[model samples]
Target: SSRYGEDLGKQDALGNLIRELARTDGIEWVRVMYTYPTHISDSFLDAIAAEPKAVNYLDMPLQHASQNVLKLMKRGGNRKSLERLIERVRERVPGIAVRTTFITGFPGETEEDFQELMSFIKNVEFDRVGVFTYSDEEGTPAYELPNKVPHRTAARRRTALMKEQSRISKRRNRKRIGEVVRVLFEGESKESELLWQGRMETQAPDIDGCVLINDVPEELLPAEGDFVNVEITEAHEYDLIGRIVLV
Candidate 1:
């Protein structure tokens, strides 16, 4: 419903709702997700930037970078437009964590198209990324499109894209070390009862990485949903290790 145009009274309405929720005293963070790239408005961006409680994060799915592939997918906006939009967002809201998804092996996608996407990814260096291989759905227009990518080729492309993103993610995470960040405690870490888990402002609840709380003073252990300042001690591929900063 949030994806619908303003004529449907849902697009800006969703942004209004998010703004209202951010004003609530009990709401520690507001994270917006699944914002379609073409429909993202200035008002929506302003709301995100102005609200102190709104996390500086956005989940905008680009799907693909190739102009030809995007035209086929009916998702308007080319690589240059996307770059400009992203730059504008960062300028409006500094330290924003932009997460995006891309699809590989779309119909008529060539090796040149795939390489263009890889270059785009390198240039953007998004905070988080998800990749998928094209899948045919019976009722979708793409299913009937010509020059469908081979299944095996699609799988290979997916793997290659993920590998590229892994390196970017690791490098981005490494930059967080030694910084004190506010983490919203989630629960005990799945791998160890002695360790707790939380997410920083840049991390969305479930889809993004986490900060592992280790060696915290007994009295300072935060309960689930509590926000605590953690001094990052280590950084891994997709996670961070930190100790509670007793303020």
Candidate 2:
């Protein structure tokens, strides 16, 4: 579920293989992660949108929106291209949850650049966002740079970005309330006597949050391959509290 690299060329073959597997008789869900912005083709996006078994979620790592930092990192795409790519994906697949990561505190990073990245995040309104303080690796150009930001400053930047994202996350999750969402049962809850744990369409295993199934009827509790319809009763910062709608 973790995609460490930024090259889509390395992932396209595997993506095709996964698509073929989705064509198999019983496969019902296929989720993809770690998409590179520059390498994602129109065909791939179309296929992803059209495939029923493929969940419309992509975890693309853009690192930073600042052109200078991106150039130093040797990343392929620019801000304009990133904007276009995002717009394309959303236009192709309505309601797709776009998840992303942004790196902070790169060498020579200006306050204006960080602010620009913040503005970009706000505009994109990503479903899930993660920010990492830049780690200087030996033999990397960034490591050899003279204008290294203080560790505290980097941490502060990371915190600030995530704080903004937290509000966005809460607002997005709130939109699901009162809507019927299909949930895949993961297990029974230990904390609450009548609560069972499950995940809705937007949630991935362990990374994103989950839905709590409370006060379920005897014949309507969740099981594997059984997608239970549940109405979102409450929305948390990262998860949902819901009761089975039994549709």
Candidate 3:
């Protein structure tokens, strides 16, 4: 919540919890969400990248890149600072999957601001991204602002942003083909047990796609909280198919 955002010191608690959970027996995956850009630090990135059990992924939502819109939303950071944080993550972690969220149609969001956001997205080349049209909550200052973007306009902008992200995601996923990725075996797919499900380091537990193994060894098929190596052979829309390399 915004309350925690007030103090950057509280940010370490979430990352610490992830480390604690990953050390647990039944905890095979530790995914972090709703991270704000301002709270990120050098230590947090180091811990996430070095942790063996934790998935090497971080989701920091920087709603808009424009300075005016950021101030209006009280996001607590500017565009330059956001870019530096993204660059820092890439520099510190070799294969880190940086996911982020965005918002469109905030009151007074201009065409220039939207273009700036698009440029930022293109430059970052994030592994995963999500976009949403602005929702005017009861207590938010945005709700009471004039020049509220129309629903259709907001939707069109959101679509444009998503289209950009979709292409980038497809390219990133395709690059993983033939790589031996460590997957946390979750369970059987709805289609059949022959089709087992799992996820690579870049993927979170539920939000991201899964690794679909067509056939599995009787002993290697995991119940849960299990880690195995899978060689990515194919990519689906949001999922992948892999052959077991280690169990």
What's the residue-level lDDT of 188 in candidate 2? 82
lDDT of 1 by residue, 1-247 (tens): 2364567655577668778999898787888778888777777778888898988998999998889899988879888999998998888889999999999989999988899899999998998999988889999888899998998998898899889899998998888888999988887998699899999888887688889989787777668888889999998777899998877
Cα-based lDDT at residue 247, candidate 3: 34
Question: Which clashing pairs does model 2 show?
Answer: none
Query: Cα lDDT for residue 211, model 2?
Result: 89
Candidate 1 residue runs with Cα over 4 Å from true position: 1-5, 8-15
Which number leads on TM-score?
1
Q: Write the per-residue lDDT of candidate 2 for residues 1-247, one digit (tens) a residue.
A: 3332335535546456556867989777887777778766665666677777878887788998888889877887667778888999899878889888988898888898888888888888899888999888998777888788887888899999999999999999998889988788777864576678788667877688888887687776556557788888898878789888767
Q: Estimated TM-score per prediction? A: 0.94, 0.89, 0.86
In candidate 1, position 4 carries an lDDT of 42
Order of candidates by lDDT, top first?
1, 2, 3
In candidate 2 the C-alpha lDDT for residue 236 amounts to: 80
